[model samples]
Target: MDVDLPYELQLVTDLRGHEERAWQIAWNPVEPLLASCSADKSVRLYNYQPSNESLKFSHIHSIPTGHTKTVRSLAWSPSGKTLATGSFDSNVGIWEREGGHDGDEEAADWECMTLLEGHETECKSVAYSSSGTLLASCSRDKTVWVWEVHPDSDFECMGVLMEHTQDVKCVAWHPSEEILASASYDDTIKLYIDDPSEDWFCFSTLTGHKSTVWALAWSPKGSYLASSSDDLTIKIWKRVAEHKWECALELKGHERSIYSISWGKGKTGEESLGWLASTGGDGKINVWDIREPPESSTGRVLSHKLIATLSSAHDVSDVNSISWCPREGFEDLLATAGDDGSVRVWKVVPSH
Candidate 1:
């Protein structure tokens, strides 16, 4: 809790669960659920409760991903029913909560529904498309894979994109379109879209990062994409036209490799994309306020204000992942995973 934030941020809770570095954390879109995957080869799910204006969490489930190696990433389905975990073991596990029936209590039994296999090496990241019909995963094998998820947990490989020259670090989908984006160790970001023939193909490759591109996030309206990199800078890109994206701005401040970034409105009832959060190997969490373009600014000329910087965000460990809580009423809440093997929650409240 550094006192230098341009905005106020309060540490709500430090969730202790994983015995190894927690690599990723994701929030359930429609529930109090927060799930974290770790190098311990396990996924821990917690139920977050808001009590007396503070965030409290109860560990509801700890699942063995059945991987021989680190569970590196986690993604929840749009319906908030399924959790997809990617592992260094080269497999993906899909988990679901049982006993969600009418009379069941708040706690539900969790079970791994299915295991998706195919990547030759580490499955670095997994993401569900906005529609929930498609899942996209990237790997250290330097490939981006898309799957068509069917009923009864059946998944068919829709496409395999292997254009990146090095390890693919993260994959993200457009908010309202079938477009997919992947960042890689090759220092580039590639965009893909579905063709009418039911195929996914790369449409554009974004360059300019000086080192490995670690993670990516899309804006609330899907108009812009933000990327974090080993170059220690976060780059913003705007869609200039269909199939084309241009660099909007390059943000520099992190002292080491940035591992993850997320976008949030930072408002409970209001509709605004107020800021973006980025966490890095430097153990700091930075809040970059997304500002409106200047009145005289032309298209795609963006600006950002550094509103907050929380030092030692993970207590002397690299912060691996971060996500802004998607629950409508708790938009200011954030979850972060780190090398410290713990998941911490924070809430931003106006400091005035």
Candidate 2:
């Protein structure tokens, strides 16, 4: 057995709230809550207190969506009051917490405010933009849809993007811009920017991966975008021209289809450059240090090191989703869901 690794995992807890596969997990940006959805046709929210001795997750609430199928993805609104969910039912549900003010949000009742319908088949993913003004959803119908969130919880169809020849796998918005990116089973990634004349239009089509592109994540500063593919590789792209993008780096280390990738700030580096944590079908969590050389001023990445590799993170159960805790007290913590029907929190020990 290999020993003396660079990182060690402390099993925070084996969160077993879902009877079926835990498909996706998300962290609320404004609050200390974590939301997870599963194949059991339900959405579960938990309030996590890192210092709790025995019980780490205080079960905040659980809502049985009553969808005909599985809940596959989740995205919380910027204010943390609204949650958008995508599911196999071919519909998007917008949930809002009711009667909850600043003081007692935990006791607020969550109600399904509205449902957005248009997808021809299973809705694979949904994401809210940084401003919370737009929500994007991708479906197996091979199309991407953008919605305009109104002040009264009503949404209007902003645009439908149909550049992908195959099923759309995931959609992600730029960190601080209105631009959006979508990955597809056709092995292509498309970037869309808001156009003044036409609502939203595709400006770039990124094609390099040999197989289906499963997921895409924008860097914290929006300078780079990382895409994971079924071909067991991750490609990082950056905008070079006005709307064109060039692949800045290609990371190939995973053995199977890469499912999830998250960009975050590295703990001990220049505040701008960050690290990445990815988990996938190979059931391994790989953290990378993406940075430039010392005293280098060209603003170009020199090398990326595989700082930590934790194999069988979820007991080799096809890890599906991972979200690094962005809170100040839990910078090294990550929440992951897998086919084992459980959510596990692991702390990264960089000192190891």
Best by TM-score: 1
TM-scores for the candidates? 0.95, 0.94
lDDT of 1 by residue, 221-340 (tens): 788899999999999898889888999888988899999999877662333446799998999988877765856777655767777778898889999998999888787888899999
Worst 10 residues of 1 by lDDT: 265-274
In candidate 1, stretches whose alpha carbon ends up further than 4 angstroms from where it belongs are 1-5, 100-107, 268-272
Model 2: residues >4 Å from true position, as ranges? Answer: 1-5, 52-55, 100-106, 293-302
Candidate 2 residue lDDT tens string, 138-235: 99999999999998899989999988999999999998989999999999999998788877889899999999999898887887899999999999
Worst 10 residues of 2 by lDDT: 1-10
lDDT of each: 0.88, 0.86
- The true-versus-predicted C-alpha distance at residue 235 of model 2, in Å, is 0.8
